[model samples]
Target: MTKLMIVEDDEKIRDELRLFFERYGYVVACATQFDHVVDEVLSAKPDILLLDINLPYYDGFYICRSIRKQSKMGIIIVTSRNAEMDELMSMNLGADDFVTKPFNTQILLARVASLAGRVRQDGVQTSVLNYGNFSLDANKMLLICGERSCELSKNEYRIAACLLRERGKIVTREQLMDDLWNNHQFLDDNTLTVNVNRLRRKMSEIHAEPSIQTKRGVGYRL
Candidate 1:
């Protein structure tokens, strides 16, 4: 089920939205504590946020910035203030969409559906991985160093994707095993080691500075 958080202060509007969306088969939550919007958001870990620009203490923009810092969750500004500047500012603050007050509930729901679908669909359409003068296409798993293109194997690509997603953070071997094999039988340690070595060799060809780094007993990072 898609989880949604409504961060508006008006009790009537909040309850209305909660009931309406819930009727449409969505798991809906409304914010009761205005002061702890960020805390509520993190705790809920909602898939999409319906936020109001005007609020007590900090406004939606502040909450939006805070959310972006920690997560890539979808944000939609559903506010009474409908100025062009407001829309632009909301986008700048990382909102996925904007819906003015007195909106058609059907249209708003449709927009939410479309945005959610896009977010889910975008997981595989990887952007180019660029570090220094080297770059690689993550979805196609093609590495480019200057004019050179290096091909990566299936296992190599999976490992690279995992490392690239975490980037500078350590990705434990257990995590890699889960990612590569789901919940299937355990893969041989030698198999993983061989794939990592192959990945490193390909990365070297692309002049990937630092390539993949091993943290001894910890894991790997890039």
Candidate 2:
């Protein structure tokens, strides 16, 4: 079972998340106390952390930076602050994922499971997927080709995995969005394009930049 720590300040939302994750068989813990949260979290040693930006005592960014420095535990920012700066700051501070408030818990659960499932308690590589000349280590979120390698963000990893899964086939935009951004309901095309382009740049580091080819009006192919 994956141990998850909830750091929300909202009593109702915190309880809601606790009940929801518990029903799914997760070992859930909530940071009910605002003070000394860092020490408590370090001691509890949960596998994943659901952090909120508007925390008492200290904010989520501070907690995220503090925890990341001491532990490699997965950190997902669950906050009401949906600004682009907030998201960028969260990622910059070493958060593994970010989800704004008013989000569907189901989608949040999926994201948690997807990230935590990659590495076990022992921190070993869980799986490596190979397609043509390149290999993607899902556990490490790394794309490799020949002697070069590049680390991928969660979304980029998903995009790469989907593309490589359908190597020769053209994966339509809708299909990619469904598999990659199902949580977003309908992700903007420009956002998807931005992500795809970013993935391409990362893949380029491994000399596999051309592996992901755009399909004019369709979607993408690997």
Top candidate when judged by lDDT against the true structure: 2
Q: Model-by-model lDDT, in order?
A: 0.76, 0.81
**Top model by TM-score, which number?**
2
TM-score of each predicted structure versus truth: 0.55, 0.57
Q: lDDT per residue, candidate 2, 1-222, as tens digits?
A: 468899988999999999988865577999889899999998998888999999888999999999888888889999989999999999999999999989997678667766665533335433555544566777688988768888888878888877755655789988888986664534578878988999998877667744688889999987
User: Cα miss at 50, model 1 (Å)?
Assistant: 0.2
Which consecutive 10 residues in model 2 have the weakest lDDT in total? 117-126
RMSD list, candidates in order: 16.2, 12.9
**Candidate 1 residue-wise lDDT, 92-150, digit = tens:** 98999999999898777766655554443223322454433455566677876667778
What ranges in model 1 sit over 4 Å off?
Answer: 120-222
Measured with C-alpha atoms, the lDDT of residue 145 in candidate 2 is 77
Estimate candidate 2's alpha-carbon lDDT, on a 0 to 1 scale. 0.81
Supply the TM-score for candidate 2: 0.57
